[model samples]
Target: MANQTSSLRSRGMEMLIAYKNQPSVELRNRLVRLNAGLVRKIAHRVSHQCSEPYEDLEQIGYLGLIRAIERFNPVQGCAFSSFAVPYIRGEMLHFLRDRGTTVKIPRRWQDLQKEAQKCQGEMIRQLGRQPNDHEMAQALCVSVEEWREVKMANKNRMPLSLDATVCHQIDSSITLGDTLPDTYYQRMQLLEEDRQQLQRAMAQLEDKTRSAIEYVFFNGLSRKEVAERIGVSPMTVTRRIQRGIDQMVAFLQPQALQTEP
Candidate 1:
C-alpha cells in the first residue's frame, strides 16, 4: 500500500510540474479540484481563533496550494505539503486578524465590564477571598441568573484604558476618579438596552446563522474554527453570517431612526 501511494504521489508530482509549466484556467481548475481535500485539510489545521468559515479558509488555502503548485521546483526536492502548510496558515491568519479586530463593542458593555470588575474586587475584599457565582450574586444584591446574564452580556468587554488609574488595591492610594469621571453608570444603562435589543434580534435569525454569529463573535472563535466544529462547509457559514448581518442591519435601522428624534 505504501509503495502504491508513493507511486501515485510521484505521478501527481509529475502532472503538477507539467501543469505548472503550462498554467492555464483549465489547469488551475483541475488542480484545485484534485487538491480540494488538501485545501480543506490545511484549513482545518491552520484555523485557530479566526471567525471566517472553513470554506473561506479553504478558499484561501486553495490559493496557497495554487501558488505552491505553480512555484514547485522538483529540482529543489522539497515535499509539496511542507512548503504549502506555512503559506496556507499564514494567509488564513492574516485574514482573521485583519477582519476580526474591526468588530465594534458597544460602549455600555465596556462600562459594565469595568463595574463588574470593581464589584468583583469589592466582594473579594468583604469576603477575604475570590467569590463563587452565588457568593458574587449575593454580594451584588442580584439573583444568580441575573448575574449570569450580565456576565454574558458583557463577555466582549474590551481592554481597560491604560490612562485609567487603579481604583483600589490593598493599601494602595490610587483611585478611579484620579483619572476619569464616573460616567460609566450611564453608559452601562445604555449598553444594557443595546444588549437586550441585540439578543432579541439574534433570536429572529435562522438557527445556523445565530449559532455561527455566537460562536464567531461571542465566543471569539474564527469562522474556520466554527465550521470545523459544526461539520459544515465554510462557504455555508459565510453565507449564513452575511444573511444574518443583513437582517440585523435592516431590523436595527428603523429603531435607530426612531431614536434619532
Candidate 2:
C-alpha cells in the first residue's frame, strides 16, 4: 500500500511538472483531482471553527489549491504539501473573514450568538424588559458568562470604521481614525500586551475548565457536542466554560489596568 501510494504521488508530481510547462484545462483539472484531498482536509479543519458549510470551504480551498499549483515551482526544492497547506488554509480563513464576522470570534461563540439572538425577542416579551445576561442564559440554557461572550461576539460584527466620526464638539473635532495611537509600533505593542494578558489568564484556569473553554469557544463546538466528547451533560459543559471565563475576566481586569497606557 505504501509503495503504491508513493508511486501515485510520484506520478502526480510528474503531471504537475508537465502542467506547469504546458497548461491545459484538462491537465489542470486532472491535477486538481489528483490533489483534491488536500482541499477537503483543510476544509474539515476550518469547518470546525466556522459557521460556513463544509462544501463552501471545500470549494474555496480548491481555488487556493489551484493558485498554489499554478504558483508552485517544483524546482524550488520544497515539498508540495508544505507549500499548499498555507494556501489552502488561507483561502478558507479569508472567506470566513469576508463573509462572517467570525474572524476574531471562535466559531462556538458565533453559534452561541445566534442562539442568544434567537431567544432575545421572546425573553424580552416574557420578561417585559431587556433580559440581563443571566436571564438570557437561563432562557437559552447556557451560563451567564457564555451569554456575555455571545454578546461580545455580536458586538464585533460591525466594528466601528476608523473613518467613522467620534465627536461633534462645537470647538473641537475628533474622528476615530485620528484618535488611534500615532505609531504602528505602539499599536502592535498594545495588541501583544493584551494577547499576553489573555494567555496568562487562560493559563490560570484548571485543566477541565481550560479544556471546556477551548473546545466550546476555540474549537467552535456546540454545548452538546462538547458534552459528548467529555462524557458529561451539556449543562456541565456550560457551567465549566462559564466558570473558566469568569476566572479569566477576574484575572484580566487588573492586568488590563496595569498594562493600560
Candidate 3:
C-alpha cells in the first residue's frame, strides 16, 4: 500500500510539473493554485536565514516559483524541486538585498556610540537593571534625538562576553583582561593612524577651504556659522565647501578602490 501511494504521489508531481509548463494560462494558474502551499513553505524555510520580514519574502518566492514553472524544461530531465529551490531562494535574497535601507553613518557617530555604551554600562551597574532610553540619554549628556540615533546604530551589534574562564592556564599565562587591553591598544593605535592620515589629507586643502570643511563637518556648524567664523558670505563659504568636497572625493576614490577587499 505504501509503495502504491508513493508511486501515485510521484506520478501526480510529474503531471503537475508538466501542466505548469504548459503555455495555457488556465493550466498554469491551476498548477500554481495547487502548489501555493508548497511555495509558501519554501519561502518560510529560506526566509528564516534573513532579517527581512517573512511576508515580503513569501511574495517574492511565489513570483520565482511562477517563473520557474514557466521556464521548466522536462526534456532536460532536471527535477522540478531541485531547480525551484534555488530559484525561490535567489528571488528572496534579491528582494532583501535591493529593498533594505542603506545608511551611510557619519564618522562622528562612532564617538556617540562609545559614549552611549559607557553610559549604559554605568546605569546598569547603578540601577542593577537595564536603563530606559531617557535615563541613558541623561547619563550620556546627549539630547534624546542623539541618544536615539546612537542606540539605533548599535541595536544590531551583539553583546560582549563576560566569561572569566581561562582557555589555557598551562604556563599560568596572561589574564584575559590583559590580552584584551593589548588588543584594544592595537585597535586604538590603528584608529589614531587613520585619523592622522585623514588630517594630513585635509591639510593639503587651501586654508579657507579647510576651515569651511572643519566648521561644517568636524564642528557640526551650519553654513551661516561657518561664514560668520571665516568673515565671508554664506554663499562664498558654500562654494568653497563644494570645491573642497570635490577635491576630497577625487583624492579618496583611488585610495578607497585600493583598500576594498
Candidate 4:
C-alpha cells in the first residue's frame, strides 16, 4: 500500500512538472484527472460548513483545480496538494458568497416560504391542527412542487441563530444554544464526531452504572435519589458514577489531528 501511494504521488508530480513546462489542453486534462481526488476531498470538507450540494461544490472545485494546474510552479518544491487545496476551497466559497445565500434560492421562493409559514400559523390557530403539504399549496395557490421547492430553499438558506429563543411560547425562555452542541463551521464536525463517540462509550458501560450516571447527569436527579431508585447507597452511587466516567473517558479520548486553514 505504501509503495502504491508513493508511485501515485510520483506520477502526479511528473504530470505537474510536464504541465508546468509545456501546458496543453491534453496535459491539463490528464493532470486534472490525476488530481481529481484532491478537489473532491476539499469539496467534502467544505460541504460541512455550507448548505451547497457536494456535486455542485465538486463542479466548482474543478475550475480551481484547472487553474492550479495551469499556474503550478513545480520547481518551487511546494506540494501540489497543499497548493491546490486553497484554490479549490476558495472557488467554492466565492461561489457561495457571490450569491446572497449559501444556495442560489430565487427571491420568489424566499417570499413564498415566508408566505406559507405565515399562512400555516394562521390556519393552525383557526383549525387547531397543522396543514398538510397539499393543503398549504392549495391555500397559497401554488403547486405542491412549488411549495416543496420553497421548503427546500428555506432549508438551504443561511442558518439561523442558536441563540434565538424557541418559537414555542411554553419554551420561549430557552435558546437552543443552551443545550445543543455548537454548530459553528469549524467546530460542527468535531462536535458531531464527539457526540457519536460519547454514545458508543456510554453504550459500553454496565447497565446499572449507565442508569445511575444517566439519572444524575441527564435527568438531573440527586445522587441520593439515584441511589434510592437503583437500590444502592449514596457512596456506592458515587463510586459507580466515577468508575463509569473513567471508563468512558478512556474509550472516548481523542487523538488530535493537526490541520491548516
TM-score top scorer: 2
lDDT of 1 by residue, 45-149 (tens): 765434356678888777777777777776688876687767777777777676653435455544444667888887778889988879766766768887776
Q: Listing every candidate in turn, what is its Cα RMSD in Å to the true structure after a full C-alpha superposition?
A: 24.5, 23.6, 22.7, 19.0
Q: List, residue by residue over 156-211, the lDDT tens digit for candidate 4.
A: 67776888776455635777776685568648888887788788999999999999
> Could you give me the TM-score of model 4 versus the true structure?
0.43
What overall lDDT, based on C-alpha atoms, would model 3 receive against the true structure? 0.75
**Residue 83 deviation, candidate 4, in Å?**
0.5
TM-scores, each model vs. reference: 0.39, 0.51, 0.39, 0.43
Better of 1 and 2 by lDDT: 2
Q: For candidate 2, what is the lDDT?
A: 0.86
TM-score of 1: 0.39
Clash numbers, per candidate: 7, 1, 0, 0
- TM-score preference between candidates 2 and 4, better one: 2
Which ranges in model 3 have alpha carbons more than 4 Å from their true place?
1-21, 101-261
Deviating ranges (above 4 Å) for candidate 1: 102-261
Candidate 2 has a TM-score of: 0.51
Error of 3 at 85 (Å): 0.7
- Name the top lDDT candidate: 2
